[model samples]
Each structure stands twice: as C-alpha cells, then as structure tokens.
Target chain A: MRFIHTSDWHLGRTLHNQSLLDEQAQMLETLLALIETHEVDALVIAGDIFDRSVPPAAAVSLLDAFLDKVIQQLKVSVIAIGGNHDGQERLAFGARQMARAGLYIQGPVSASISPVRVDGKHGAAFFYPIPYAEPALVRHLLEDESIQSHQDAMAALLSKVQAHNSNGLPKIVVSHCFLDGGSESDSERPLSIGGADKITPALFTPFDYAALGHLHGPQYKGAEHVRYSGSPLKYSFSEQHQNKSVTLVDMVPAKAPDIRLLPIKPQRDVRIIEGHLDTLLAQGAKDPGRDDYLMVRLLDTHAILEPMAKLRAVYPNVLHLERTGLMQERSMEGPGRERMQKSELTMFEDFFNQVQGESLSGPQKALMSDLIASLHREAGQ
Target chain B: MRFIHTSDWHLGRTLHNQSLLDEQAQMLETLLALIETHEVDALVIAGDIFDRSVPPAAAVSLLDAFLDKVIQQLKVSVIAIGGNHDGQERLAFGARQMARAGLYIQGPVSASISPVRVDGKHGAAFFYPIPYAEPALVRHLLEDESIQSHQDAMAALLSKVQAHNSNGLPKIVVSHCFLDGGSESDSERPLSIGGADKITPALFTPFDYAALGHLHGPQYKGAEHVRYSGSPLKYSFSEQHQNKSVTLVDMVPAKAPDIRLLPIKPQRDVRIIEGHLDTLLAQGAKDPGRDDYLMVRLLDTHAILEPMAKLRAVYPNVLHLERTGLMQERSMEGPGRERMQKSELTMFEDFFNQVQGESLSGPQKALMSDLIASLHREAGQ
Candidate 1:
C-alpha cells in the first residue's frame, strides 16, 4: 500500500497581513500533480485544515474546490482529522455523508476507535486516525480521571486502537501532535505552555508507519518510520530556512515501510536581507527581488528618510523593515523614566529623537517652548 | 403529491436580547411531527434559513440535527433556496455532494434551472428552485443587460422554467422574494427601502403551485396556490398578533392544488399589555405571567421607581417596559437644549423632579446647591 502524507494546510492564513490564498491554491495544484504522478492510493491529512476555527468565506470555497477535484475527480480516498486550530464540530458536520465519497473526517476522540480498512496488494491496510482533542475531553470520554496531559490521552487512545486491531494487518497511525525532539517554529501554536503536551515516538510500536503533524519542519524521530510532512508554505520568518515537503510512504505486510520526501516550491519565497540603505538599494537595482516577500533590516546607524517607501520602489512585496542594530542597543538601556520627569520640552525632544532618529531643530525647539508657556498660562487661569 | 412549505426560519434569532434557540428547537420538533402526520413527500424551505449570513455554532448544530432526522431517518426530500440575508457562496458549498442525500440547496440563480422530479401517486411532481439573486447577478448570469429590477429577474427565471417543461407535470415553484400586496412586519427585513423588489403574483401563472418566503405573515396573494407560509415563530413585537403556521399543499396533475395551514405553537408566547403601573403590578401578582415573554406599557402620568425590576419580580420574562403617557407628553415639548440655559441649581431641581416625580426636600435642595458650588470651584482650579 502506498499513500501520500501531508498536513497543516492552514487555509486562510495571512503573513504580515498579506493573504496567502493565491500561493496556497498554487501549492494544491502541485500536490494534485504529484498524486497523479506517484499513483498513490490514499491521502492522509493529519490536522489543522484551517488557520482559525471560523475561516473567511473565500477559504471555505477554496477547500471545497480542492476536495472536489481530489475526491471526485481523482477518485482517491482521503483521511483527515481536526487539529487544535480547527473547530471539531464544524469539521465533523457532514462526515457520515461525505464518507460515501471516500472522504473520512474524524473530529473527536471516541471510546471505540474504527479504522478505515483499504484493500491493498499486500492485504488489507488499516488507517487509524486520532484527531486533536484536549485532555479534559479525553478524560471525560474515557471516564478516566488519570488522563491529565496530552501524553496520557494519546496513551489511552493507542490502547483502544491496540485492542481493536486483532487481525494484525499492516497498520498506520495518523495523528496531530507535537512529538518529542521535533523542531518548533514561531507560527505553530504550542499545544501547551510548558512541554507537557509532547508525546514519545515509542507509542506507535505496533504500527508500521506514523504520519505526524504540528511542527513546521519536515523531519523524523530516532527511527525513519515516523515523520512530519510539515506545512507546504512558509508561514513566518522563522521558517524561511526550512524546506517544505510532503512524505510518501510505501508499506507492505510484515516489513518496514519506505518513506520519501517530495519538496514543494512556493509561488513566492520568503527571504530576509540585511545591509545599509545605499548598498541594499544598489543590490535591489541589480537583482530586483520583486517577486519574493521580503524582510529587510537596515544596518546604518543614522536615520534614513522613508526607507520603507524607498525600498518598496524596487521590492514591491517587502513586508517588514527595522533598524536592528539601533534597536538592540536601545533594548540594553534601562527605562527612560528619569528623563521623562524633566521639563515637558525636554521630554518632547527625547521622544522626537527616539522615534525619528534625529534631534529637534532650533526652530522646532522654539515652537515647543512657546506651546509650553501657553499651557502654563492656561493652567494658572 | 403532498409537501410542507416553510421559510424564514431565522435560526439563531434573538428577541429583546433573549435567545430564542429553545423556542426554535421546540418549533422544529412540532414541524417534524407535522411532516410525519401529514405524510408529506417533500419539505420546501424558501429562504433565510439563518438570521445572519454567519450563524453561531449552536444554530448550525440545530439545522444539522433537523436535516439528519428529515433526510436520513424519515427519507423525505428537502428543496431550499437562499434569501437576501444569506451568503450565497457559503450556502452553495457542498451542494452537489449533498444532493445525493436528497437535500437540494440553490444559492445563485442560473440560466438552466433543473427540476428535482419525484414520482407521486397522481403523476411526476417537478420542483424547480429559484434562489434569491440580485438584478446584477441575474443580468450577468443570463448575459442580458436589460434586466434591472427584481421583477425582471423573476420573469427571466420563470420563462426558463416554462421552456424546460416539455411534458405535462405537476410543477411547483419555490422562491424567496417580496411579492405584491403581502403585509410587512418589523422583523422582516425590507427587500428594498421603497418596495422596488415587489414582484407581481402573475409571474407564477405557469406553475401549479408557488411556495414563497420572505414575508413573516402566513397569507396568500390573490390566489390560494401562491402563498407565503411565514416564519414558524413570531420574531418581533409587531408580529405578536400573527398565528405562526406552515403551509401544506396537495397537488395532482393538471389541476389546482389544495392548500392547508398547520398552526405551530411556540414554547413561549410573546405578548404586549398596557395599564397603569399599580394595576399591571396587581395583575401580574395574580396571573404571574412567568411563562410568557411580555412587553409592558405604563400609562401612569408620573415616573415610577424601577418599574422593570418590579414587574420582573412577578413576571420573570418581562423583557421591556415604557412610560408611554409621560414620554409622549415630553416629546410634545420642544428640544431640551432651551431648558439647559437656566441656572445650574434650577436645572438640577427640574431634573430631580422629573425623575423622582416630586420636588426635593429642604435638606436635599441645600445639599444639591453645595455640591454645585464645589463643582464650580474644581473647574476653576
């Protein structure tokens, strides 16, 4: 049995207030082509189908169109589950009816687990889906007071799956969780504040392959059977260095599975560049990184007039700008409360220099003194 | 052929800040019972299934449960359309897949409108759904620039339906729009500010029956076959006099249809009452209108203390209160801006008398004067 493993689509996501819908649509087009070329039997989407619980209408339409092409046009079975960012009830709305079209979605943890069994050349391949659920919900569902963390919840769920699988078919476990030793990124919401939500890879001892989602980096644990396919697009500057890919797994009965990574190229790459304003502009004139979304940091010590507008003239997609060297120096200094206790005129001058990176002119200082005198007169009256 | 015609469910609607979800659930229970008792072959929901384009999760769950029972358990077909209040794209999502389960939801109007044909005891019953579409959408869809008003759009849709029916069948037209001569209510959003959306009832001459929505009053338009079944519950104080009901139609081939009204009783009745404060309080003490949601008008000439709270002490569901007589008298006078020109002491005295319904005592008047002096001193400083 061969299947394509992917997760964390995060449809309707925006980077620095810019919509990624177009890039997301292009990524899905590439995915469909890969599925056709590989001739994969089943598709596994672990979790996080949407960026937020309530997505905008355009996101809903995009998902609808994508599913129609994959399930109805390609005629492949898809197994999906809810992630922490998903509203479980919303995702599970029409699961029963959609199941007829080979779209299986599980939202909540149930006491009795059912595996979607698919007949393959190596016999029946059983796919077990464990959707994202809170410890409280798992505790309530199992009526077990000892389930206090995500690790405990997964242990209980795996035990149920173990009890149900008496046929000993080639088993695969699909889940949305933060496995131990997986790299983290700024965009992925941590399952818990502390590290209490991490689960060990050993929980899948009986399964041939474990397809995991949560981290934004495509990687494996100590063994090669368990892997994270990662998000298809970079969602933050912290993920700019990571190559996004989907995992393709080939499994045969009573044998180890073979895993391969198929890299996905986004429509516009997210890149970071740092230099003085003049040098950056000269580089932009030569290369003109107009298509890539960019974050530029100015290394010049002095202030530059409207640097963002100037850089955007060449790089239209520049999303963020900052004076990193000056900012770091300012952070090392303590709070400026004593300076604020001085005369209002001095305080205004300090604020002006801090923001614009220049001291007040003689004329500007004279105008400020006049305004302060009038304010004192008004108070005296 | 027999069918139940209902519309403007306005699920997730609230009245006077009170959630009507409980009442809506009860009303749906009654509707299901009626569907079974009448043995209706199909259920027609004309439009406005939800109060807003995006409903809360609970409202979605209620609609889901209702559809599950009707389409899955009872094996009845439902044909629905989008209204002006609905988001057309959202309502049309997954419509093609859902059609397999006998749930047909049409959002935008198209040139080729297909009928959901069901064989009845008499003949084949053809149900054509024309969802709510603006003039601009209709013009673009048909590529006819002449379409301007809603009447023109409806006329174009009906003509298409006329062309499609080559054989003699019992035809039923389902739509959501404002028809001519129908009574209006506050809760029913006006399709247009000046009745520009009113379409003549003669447009339905080609069909055996027209099941309409949009008007919250259950009434016919010059003929028995063309009707608005109204909403199943009163959504506003202005609609308190209406007897909420659903229309049941029995049709046969090439003949006039038989229409009947099945009244639905809500869990709590919305009522309005008028009397002096003391008389209303006494009445409330005896009858204790705790079950009914009430609106009260106090006819007393002077202000009363905490009338809303006092009334709610006996009638827990009293949602609104008004001093109608005094309020009317006050409005008859000119703007209060003129009274503000008087001395501060005099202004305070008048305000005290108006609210308390009596002049202040000597000690109270002295305290007010002293407080005014202190305020003036503070302002000077």
Candidate 2:
C-alpha cells in the first residue's frame, strides 16, 4: 500500500494579518500533482485541517474544492481527523453521509477505533484515525479512572485498537498529538499549558506507520516509522529555516515501510535580516526576491524618519521592524519610584522621549505646556 | 408526484434573546412524521434554511441531523436553495459532492438552471430551483444590460427554465422571493428597500406549480398552483395569530396540482396579554399554559416594583413588558427645546420623575443636591 501523508495545512491562517488562502490553494495544487505522479492509493490528512474552530467561509470553500478533486475526480479514499484546533461537532457534522463519497472524517474520539480498509497493489491496508482528544474525554469514553494526561489517553485508546487488530493486517495510525522530543516553533500552539500532553515514542511502535501532526517540523523520534509531516508553509519568523515537506509511505506485507520526503516550495519565502537601516535599504534595492515576507532588525541607535515607508518602497512585503538595542536602552532608562513624585508635565516629556527616541522639539514642548495650563484652568473654573 | 413543501426555516433564530433550537428540532420531528404518513416522494425547502449567514455550530448540527434522517434513513430527495440571509459560498460548499447522497443545494443565480428529476407514482416530475439573486447578479450572469430590478431578474431566470422544459414533464418551480400582493409581517425582511423586488404573479403561469418562500404567512398568490408554505414557527409577536404550516402538494401530468395545508403546533404558543398588573398576575396563576411566551402591556399608572420579575414567577417566559399608561404620559410630557435653557438640576429631577412616575423622596432629593454641590466644588479647584 502506498499513500500520501500530509498534516497541519492550517487553512484560513493569516501570517502577519495577510491572508494565505491563495498560497494554500497553490500548495494543494502541488499536492495533487505529487499524488498523481506517485499513483498513491489513498490520501491521509492527519489533522489541524482548519486554523481555527470557526474558519472564514473561503476556507470551507477551498477545503470543499480540494476534497471534490481528490475523492470524486481521482477516486481515492481520504481519511481526515479532527485536531485540537477543530470544533468536534462542526467537523463531524456529516461524516456518515460523506463517507459514501470516500471521504472519511473522524471528529470525535470513541472507545472503538474503527479502521477503514482500503485496497492497494500490495494488499488490504487498515487505516486507523485517532482524532485529538483530552484526558477527561478518553477517561469517560473508556470508563477508566486511571487516565490522567494525553499520554495515558493515547495508551487507553490504542489498547482498544490492539484488541480489535486480531487479524494482524498492515496498520497505519493517523493522529494529531505532541510527541516527545519533537522540535517546537513559535507558530505551533502548545497542546497543554501544564506540559502534560506529550506522548512517548514507544506508544506508536506497533503500527507500520504513524502519521502525526501538531509539531510544525518534519522529523522522526526513535523509530523511522513515526513522523511529523509538518506544516506546508512557514507560518512564523521562527519557522523561516525549517524545511516544509510531506511524507509518502510505501508498505508491503511482512516488511518495513519505505518513506520519502517530498519538499514543497512556498510561493514566497519568509526571511529575516539584521543590519543598519542604510545597509539594509541598499540590499533590498538589489534583492531579486523582493516579494518575500521580511522581518528586519535595525542596529542603528538613533531613530530614522519613516524607516518603514522607506523600506517598503523597495521591499513591499516588509512585515515587521525593530530597533532592539535602542529599545533595550529605553526600557532601562524608564522612570522608577521617583516617577510618582514628579509632576505630570515632566513624566509626559519622559514618556514622549522614550517612545520616539528623542526629546521633544521646542514647538512641541510649548504646545504641551499650553495644553496643561488650559486643563488646570478648566479645573479651577 | 407527492411532496412536502416548506421554507423560511430560519433555524437558529432567537425570540428576544431566547434560543429557538428546541422548538426547531421538535418541528423537524413533526415534519419527519408528516413525511412518513403522507409517503412523500421528495422534500423541497425553498430558502432561508438558516437564520444567519454564519449559523452557530449547534444549528449546523441540527440541520445535519435532520438531513441524515430524511435523506439517508428515509431515502427521500432534498432540494434547498440559498436565501438572502445565507452566505452563498458557504451554503454552496460541498454541494456537488453532497448531491450524490440525494441532497441538492443551489446557490448563486445563473443563466443555466438545472432541474433535478425524481421518479414518483405519477411518472416523472422535474424540480427547478432558482436561488435568490440580486438584480446586478442577474444582469451579469445573463449578459443582459436590461435587467434592472428583481422582477426583471426573476423574468430572466424563468425564461431559462422555460427553454429547458421542452420534454413536457410536470415542472415545479421552487423560488425564494416576495410576490406582489402577498401580506407581510414584521418578521419578514423586505427583499429590497426600494420595493423593486416584488415579482408579479403572472411569472408562474408556465409551471405546473410554484412553491414560494419569503412571506411568513401561507397563502396563494392569484392561483391555486402558486403558494407560500410559511414558516413552521412564530418568529415574532406579529406572527402570533398566523397559522404556521407546511404545504403538501399532489400533482399528476397535465393537471392542476392539489395543495393541502398541514398546520403545525408550536412547542409554546406566543401570546399577548393586556390588563392591570394585579389582574395579569391573577390570570397568570390560573392559566394552564403558563409556560407560553408572553408580551404583557400593564395599564397601571404608578410604577410597579420589578414587574418583569414578578410576572416571571408565574409566566416564566414573559419576554417583554410595557407600562402602557405611564409611558404614554411620560412621552407626552417630555422636555422640549425650551428645556435647553433650564438648569441641570431641574433637568435631572424631571428625568427621574418621568422614569419613576413619582417625585423624588426626601433622602433621594438631598443626595442629588449634595452630588451637584460636589461637582461645583471640584470645578472650582
């Protein structure tokens, strides 16, 4: 059995408040091309299909279009599961009816993890979808009081799957979880604030392949069979250096699965640069990839006049700007306990200087003094 | 051919901030029973399936459950369309894929109107769905600059359906629009603010039957074959007296369609009661349907102490309250332009007197006087 494994599409997500719908559409097109080239039997989307519980309408439309092409046009079965970011009821709305079209969506976790059987060139492969669930939900569903963390929940869930797998068929487990030892990034939300949601690598040892989501980096832990396909696009500055890719797995009866990483090229790269404003402007003027999203850190100590406007003239996609050295100095120099004893006028001047990195001009000082006098006069009336 | 016609479901609607989901679910159950008893071949939902473009998740779940019962369990075809309240793209999402399961939803207006044919005891009947469209959209789709009003848009749409009906099959046109001479209520939104959306009754002359929506009251428009099924529940107080129903239509080739109105009993009746506060309380304690949603008009001249709370003790669903005689007097005696020259203290006293329907007590008057003195003192600082 051969299949394309992808996860963390995060559709309807915005990077620096810029819509990624067009880029997401382009990436799905590339995914389709890869599927056709590899002649994959089925498509497995692990989870986090939508960025949020209630996504915008355009996101729904895009997912619908992609499913129509893959399931209806290509005649391939698709197995999708709901992640932590998904609304379980919304995702599970029409799962039963949609299954008739070869689109299987598992939104809620249950005690019996039913495996969907699909035919391939090798033999029949059983695909098990384990959607995201909390410890309380798992405990309630299994009627077990010992389940406490996400690790315990997965253990309880897998025990049921193990009990049902008496046939010893080739099995693939698709799940959305934060596996232990996976690298983290800024854009990926922590599964649990208390740091109790991580699952050990040994829990996935029984499956021929474990397609995982939630950690936005393509990697493996301990064994080659378990992997995180990662996000298709760079969602934050911290992820600028991570290589985004999807996994394709090939399996045969009584043998280890073969895996290949298919790299996806984003429409525009996310880049970060640090230098003096003048030097950065010079580089921006000559750069060929000017449309890439950029976060710039300026080393200059003094404030520049409308630096963002100047930078955007040459690099239209500059999303962020920072003067880290000067900002640190201003923070250290801010008013302390003496601020309460100082007059309002003196405090205002200090705040203005701190924000703009300069003292008030002569005319501006006069304006402030006059405004304060008027306020006092009004109070005295 | 025999079918059940219903429209303007407005699922997820609220009456005075109270959710109508339970009532809607009960009504759907009644509708399902009706379908079974009548042995209906298809279910036609003209438009307005949801109350808002972005319905709550619970509403989506309810609608999905209803569809699962009707389409998957009973094996009946469902044909729905987008109304002005629906987000067209959202409603139309997954339409092509859902059609395989005998559920059809049409959104956006176009020149090509595809008819879904269902086999019935009377031979074959073709159902043409014309979703609501603006005048501008109609003009753009048909490539006709002359389409300027909703009437023109409907005319242009019907022309296409007429051209497609050369097979001489029994045709039923399902649409969502306001027809001329139809009596409307407060709950129904005007299709167009300029009144250009009202279509003439003659537009349905070519079809064997026209199942319409948008009006809350079920009534025939000029002919027996053309009718509105009305909403299944009272959405507003204005519709409290209107009988809510679904239309059951029976048709054969080359004959006038037979229509029957099946009245639906609401979970709780919306009622209006007017009397003195004492008299209302006496009546509320004795009424059998005390749980009915009530709008009360109290005729007391003096202010009642927490009237809403008092009424709710017996009538738990009292959604609105109006102090009729005192409010009328207050409105008549409101301050006019001449009061602008009056002192703030006098204005405050008058406002308090009007709201309370009595002058300030000794302690209250002294507190107000002291508050005014403190304000003056602060200004003099």
Best-matching candidate per lDDT: 2
| DockQ per candidate, 2 decimals | 0.33, 0.45
Query: Poorest 10 consecutive residues of model 2 chain B by lDDT?
Result: B336-345
Candidate 1, B1-381: lDDT as tens digits: 899999999988999999999999999999999998888889999999988877777887788779878888878888989887776666666666667777888866777897888664434588999988888889999998999999998999889888776467777899999889889988988877777899998998667889999999998886789899999999988888999999999885556888889999988888888888778878876774456888888887555557788788777888888778657655655565432222456656766886878898999988887787777677662
Cand. 2 TM to true fold: 0.86
A142-202 per-residue lDDT for model 2 (tens digits): 8899999999999888876676763777888999999888899898878889789899989
Clashing pairs in 1: none
lDDT of each residue in B1-381, candidate 2, tens digit only: 899999999988998998999999999999999988888889999888888888888988899889999988888888888888777677776677777888888877667997988876546688999998899998998899999998899998998778885477788999999999999977887888978889998998678999888888898897988889998889888888999999999986567888899989988988788889888889888898889888888887655557899899989999988889666655555475322222445557767876778888889878887787677677762
lDDT tens digits, residues A200-230, model 1? 8888666688888888889888578888899
Q: What are the per-model numbers of colliding residue pairs? A: 0, 0
Off by over 4 Å in 2: A110-112, A165-167, A324-381, B328-381
